[model samples]
Target: MKSSIVIADDHPLMLKGMMNYLSSLGYNIVGSATDGSTAYNLIVKLKPKIAILDIRMPHKTGLEIAQDCKLNALDTKIILITFDKREDVYKKAKEHNIYGYILKEFAVEEIETCIENVICDRPYFSKELVPNLEKTYTNTDYTSLNKLTKTEIKILKQIANNKTSIEIADDLNVSPRTVDKHRSNIVNKLKLHGIHNGLFIWASQNKDIF
Candidate 1:
């Protein structure tokens, strides 16, 4: 069956253009909205197979909607279209399990393929993001810091202050195992494999960020 989709963008022309283009591509365009709140409501009500959202929008951002969908265990796959190439934004999308991330300029060229891939349960990211995304795996500088989630940052900050995992868990009201899991995720995201006390060392050096 052809996939059902809802698209939202703050830009009227861009919203209409994408809606029409996707319709031309033979997908069922069930809904379209020019504001994030309306778009979120529409998706919740219609339960479309896919949702294409502008990363920046009034009321609620695309990332915010994607997070809400994840928290609610909704089945709609989210594709975030944006001009921003900030690594932190990309990391947040990945954290929220967003299905696709497409650049606005490349939306016409890439959106169809992104939709096709995500509808089949595959993740998609625009080609332009390849270089920077790759760097997050290799670079150890503040750029790589984008890979850390908010909770990870907090845990890392506590670690930088010489707090033990048990102490951090006590302070944050979570179990030490949970704190350790966040540490593991932080280490993995920063690619700190084979390094002794890597997270503590990195956190000590980058304490200024926290």
Candidate 2:
């Protein structure tokens, strides 16, 4: 079956370019919208097989719309598009299990590949953006981890370095309670839940992200 798709973007030219490109690929273009709210409404009503969404939009962000679709139990697979290669955007996309992320300029050429990979139930990160993701990790400072504040990174590095909470507190000139709060914030910001799982393990393995 052809993948039923809804295209959402604020720019008229971009919307047209994407719609034209995808339609030529023989996919069914179910609908198009200029903003996230309209897109969400159309998605709920049309129940498309997949959605191609721009990250920035008026009324609501594409990420917010994706969350709503998930909350409403819509079956549409989402392919989030972005112009900027922002790390926080990627983190949010990962947290939401978004099917694919393609840079807008590359969409005309790379989108077909992204859709195919997503249809095969695989995660698709644009080749143009992988280097940015790697850069985020490699350039992380104990002062500025991606999407994390300076204090958060310091606490995370301390944890990764096998420091106890009290040790971290003393080292950072904060109280143990404050250190614990920072730890909790770090875990939540990184979407790490449960015991002995999530970024704690990932961070330990990639110590340089600390």
Candidate 3:
């Protein structure tokens, strides 16, 4: 499930705002903290699928917690939030395998996109930091739909025709769970977040593209 998120920031307001924002977006906010140590501990205990952390915090920085997760072989993906825009910090995050890099200034704007990409196994960085990004990560367009596999596109066509997961599964000779997984991958590959009925709507609107 692309749910259960834990967020932490040294600032009380930042932490609160992030918590509320994510909750409003239908994400399950499992826990939140005002310091990095508590944040890391919560991640270890709750085992959420995603961790959103301030780049700098008391006891342990976000990068340190990311390193800890890797050293312990945790599956939680780290999305680092920061005001820092230094290329060095970006490089460090890459070394720690951080899934998303977002600027606090644009957190509210970019976070939904960041989470969408992260859960899909794509590295996401704030567009404001384009200079620090690689070719694929920098300024992208609808062409990202090309990233979807043939089976994924077929599932999407079924979706566009208003087919249910079970129906699509039956037609594709796959399990319902497999169809649901493909739906998720289609959402991620298409970078569709925040929209109601994103998959169905996108497939309905862009039929020619597929």
Candidate 4:
């Protein structure tokens, strides 16, 4: 029997393309959703064998939906798709224990391999994702960067994006103090303490990938 799967992405063209590709490969295309909320709702009803989720959806990110699925005790294997290629996102996905991680640029054959591996209970991470993740640790000043955690790096990205601590806290569902603590740690780690203007400049230069 073929494995049942659901594909969730905001873009219609990509969504249809993925569905057609997977169908051609002989996997059952159980359903498709254009946003994370609908995906979560459909998974609860459809109970597919696997879910292919796009990372950058509008309502809630693929990461957020994954967490919700896990909390609800859903058994569907998750295959994460992303174009961001950001180390922070990759680290978070690994921490979430996802079944497969696929970069958008990888060949369709690679995606098929990922699905097969994950269905067999093995985790699969595309080769590009691994190196991009390693690039995070190699470039930053390890001695000081060590003081900050992966979560902190995520928060740092939010700050660089011009999000206020309150905004970040609300979005991540954390307390304001937690956000502030992350900011403080990041500033100290980069040795940009008391240098508000330079913080953005430094982050812009580094682009958060070594």
RMSD of each: 11.8, 11.7, 8.5, 12.8
TM-score of 2: 0.64
Which pairs of residues clash in candidate 1, taking residues 3 or more apart in a chain or in different chains? none
lDDT per residue as tens, model 4, 1-105? 579998999989989999999898899998999999899888899999899999889787889888888788899988898887777787677656577888887
TM-score of each: 0.66, 0.64, 0.64, 0.62
Q: Tell me, by TM-score, which candidate is best.
A: 1
lDDT of 1 by residue, 1-210 (tens): 489999999999999999888888798999999899999999999999999999999999999999899899999999999999988888788778888899999999999888987775556778888556645333456677787788998898888776877789999999999998998998888777754345654665567766
- Sort by lDDT, top down from the best: 1, 3, 2, 4
Model 4 per-residue lDDT at 173: 97
**Clash count list over all predictions:** 0, 0, 0, 0
Please, what is the whole-model Cα lDDT of each candidate in the order they appear?
0.85, 0.77, 0.82, 0.77
Clashing pairs in 4: none
Name the candidate, 3 or 4, with the larger lDDT value. Answer: 3
Over 4 Å off in model 3, which ranges? Answer: 132-210
Give the per-residue lDDT digits (tens) of candidate 3, residues 78-171.
9999999887787788778788889989999999988986675556768787544443332337688778899998898888766778888899
Model 2 spans with C-alpha error above 4 angstroms: 134-210
